[model samples]
Target: MAEEQPFALQRHEKLMERLRLHGAVRVRELADALGVSELTIRRDIAALADRGLLTRVHGGATLPTVLDETPARRRRASAPAFTIGMVVPSLDFYWPQVVNGARSAAAAHGVHIQLRGSSYDQAEDRRQILRLVESGQVQGLLLAPSLEGPGVAELIDWIGGLSVPAVFVEREPPRWTPTPRPLEWVRSDHALGLELAVRHLHAFGHRRIGLVLSKGSPTSAHLAAGWHRACEELDLPDDFVVRESVALNVPGHREIIGGIVDRCRRDRITALVVHSDPDAISVAQYLTEQGASIPDDMALVSYDDEVAHLAHPALTAVRPPKTTVGRTAVDMMMARLLEGRNRPVQRTLVLPELVIRASSITSSWQRETPPAG
Candidate 1:
């Protein structure tokens, strides 16, 4: 016989087993089998649902998707049940997980998602949204557009005036003006994510922490807000802040990353929070070139989890729940279709988690020793 584990762990394990065997599990049945109350089973299901491990239905939980089900079968079965058009900023990096999560939820609810890719440019965002709107086949939309650019106001008004139900994914409404039409939104709490990173570095004995933000990222403002707030709350110095976009492939990019590395070295900054994985990778490389060992010499934490694991040391990162965000967006759209204007506008902020790795485990800072030519 195997040794017993904690009750919650045991219950969750058993639930997974049941889902694998039956494709779904009812709360009453699970409660009876586990000798627990139905309420306990419901709570467990809710927790599992939040983690994207399972999808909660009226009276039971189901496996998120049929792993063996082919796309052809899924499309054939779901055949325009409730067509939803989705426009996202990019098909590569970060957004794919969001799309997959939405697809899973659509499959569960017997709906279909029509996906379109766009760039960060306002014009491009509008083009994608218009393409979806003109399709005539879609009754709803999920959009992640350039909410910060000059065209944002016009775009928001256009979306608000749309005849179909729409939901914003990974974007928030402008607080500056009252929306022409009520809109629903779902996004990761990037501000909270920054605070999580700061706390993690602080826990590891890093005091003089620094932050580097990608210039045009939508989440940068929220992250900076969190960073500053955390610094104030924790009584840590917050003087070292860099706000620039570094394109490693561009000419003169080396100097920008080199400058950042030099500043950190001179300021005795023990830890740094870098937004997005690509820039973080560049900084890590530049720092290594300066003879600074990651974690040992300077602790590093990347904000976006998308490709952070690919870094040399496998970065500690704040991971937005991309999959869950996608899945919930679809769910919100479904609710809007069913409830119409009867349901209150939903604005959800999903919490992000810090994935600890080798890059942020040092107990003390080790100053960089520049490499000899």
Candidate 2:
């Protein structure tokens, strides 16, 4: 489950989006759309009204600037200014929140988001992107293309020469010389997220820690870099990094996990920081079957927060700010459309948040707020 603060923030984002899209939002409609009670929506409206972000009407709330405007003017103001095409690999797991955030921001700004699902293949990425671009319906594009392939450079160049503005969401172009039109991107700083995990383990009195990065992931390289830097900074024992994955899908994963557990026992490694939640839980479950106690025998921290809270001991995790990245991608595209060539090329990195849980802490230890950086 999401925390109250993040949940309320998401509600406010949706509320403002509704207000912007329709110039006003009825309480009943908002309750249904947001899956909250009318009373909760009213409270939200009241809170927004106090902040002067919206004005409470008879049964709804209107944009702060729209309450006094004429009907015709309001309609003109609320009309969609742009339609953006988006292509992403999957609508499940990590990308759904991103799409939702982009949709919320698009609605809030009177922009439309037309999404297309594609398989995570370079060929499919090209097909989906070219289909949207050649259709000429979209004023801009928000794309998350497959970044690892022989033709990646060609793909980037093709996208760079497009007629409409394009923003890469959660993807970066591989190292290349500057084209006449450089691509812009917004992604989470996973490297720093890995550092957060190591620092948290260090503060929890772990001196000999291990890192297990997921194989065949774009994010693994970043996590490995972070692991190396954090180990150097913390002056912890080294030579314990495992780059390959032990996911259930891998053949002979039991042996792989057993070797990992045996290495920890030999090295006296008390804690581990893993790239993702599924892999972390696999290791944790294996350890449990071996009669090991979490935190007592082996504490664990996972990088992705997708299913961390669902773990048996409730894994501590680094939660990437995926929604914020999505919202920012749209906002950046809007700025590019408005500013045209005057806008500087941007490569923005948003930070991930660390959420502490039982797996990484002792019973007597209270959860401390994570560092802002």
Candidate 3:
């Protein structure tokens, strides 16, 4: 009991800190972070709830709210009242988890989400958004519109001017200058995600590391920022970077990847962090075809976990909390609809998770994970 007291106290402290930061805490996440069992985390949550520290919700605990934020209580006694229109650049890849997460939260709150798939084009995003708005079916919006190009500033203003409340899913408002209105957003801290990857490789005795970014991705800028900042902090070289789409279908992809490989050899880079799985997998396939080995020849860490495990060597990856981002956006939407502008503007930043696997680790690496889940 005495030995357990200190550990329990530490766990309680962490739970409170996370709740204060993100407004909620998940049981599975807490267990993983603390290296404890889910049952143990539940018990800790119970103890905390008994102290009026938090309100227990399904699979998690949240800040105590008078309306009872738990889904068990909020589960539609009747049909939903409000409908939220959701638009994403792609229905596939990174957006699905986020959409599913929104669906989960919306179901709990007895709300409907009208989803529309758009491309990365700002004009297409506007067209989709306008169609949803012009239909007069939605009272709120959960948008993942293109945050690039010259027209983005005007788009941000237009979204803000809409009669309904809006939440940005995995997107942020303009950063170059302030918008006419304070926007609400939730996104994975991709910068910090890259930092995690860089630091992880550094600890594994990798002195020189490179970063390869997918061209034209909004997330790429954040990843690059993180790579530079982390490298600077670690005193690692920041010279080796490739800012191009090196995925399989891209024109001259083989030559593009070949150049990257040749550069790594010339620079003696021992580790590389590639943004997104397709690019990472391309590099992996090319390396294998050339008879080089992963982690042995060049340790590889991919940015997105989507399909990273499906790669030949099973890449270690930075998994952005996509579901959490979506859930949080909906939660904020609920707050906005309920309290209106009385509630403070929220621009939440959720961190990404690093899933260790075969590609980024050798036998001697301490924090190793199973090759397949």
Best by TM-score: 3
Is candidate 1 or 3 superior in TM-score? 3
Candidate 3: stretches off by over 4 Å: 1-74, 175-181, 363-373
Using lDDT as the measure, the top candidate is 3
Candidate 1 — which residues are off by over 4 angstroms? Answer: 1-78, 363-373
Tell me the tens digit of each residue's lDDT in model 3 across 247-268.
8988899999999999999999
TM-scores for candidates 1 onward, in order: 0.75, 0.76, 0.79
**Backbone clashes, each candidate:** 0, 0, 0
Global lDDT of each candidate: 0.84, 0.83, 0.86
Where model 2 places Cα greater than 4 Å from the true spot, the runs are 1-78, 363-373
Minimum summed lDDT over a 10-residue window in model 3 is located at 69-78
Residues 283-370, candidate 1: write the lDDT tens digits. Answer: 8888888888888888999998888999888999999999999999999997666445545688999999999988998634323433
Q: What shift in Å separates residue 155 of candidate 1 from its native position after superposition?
A: 1.5
TM-score, candidate 2, is 0.76
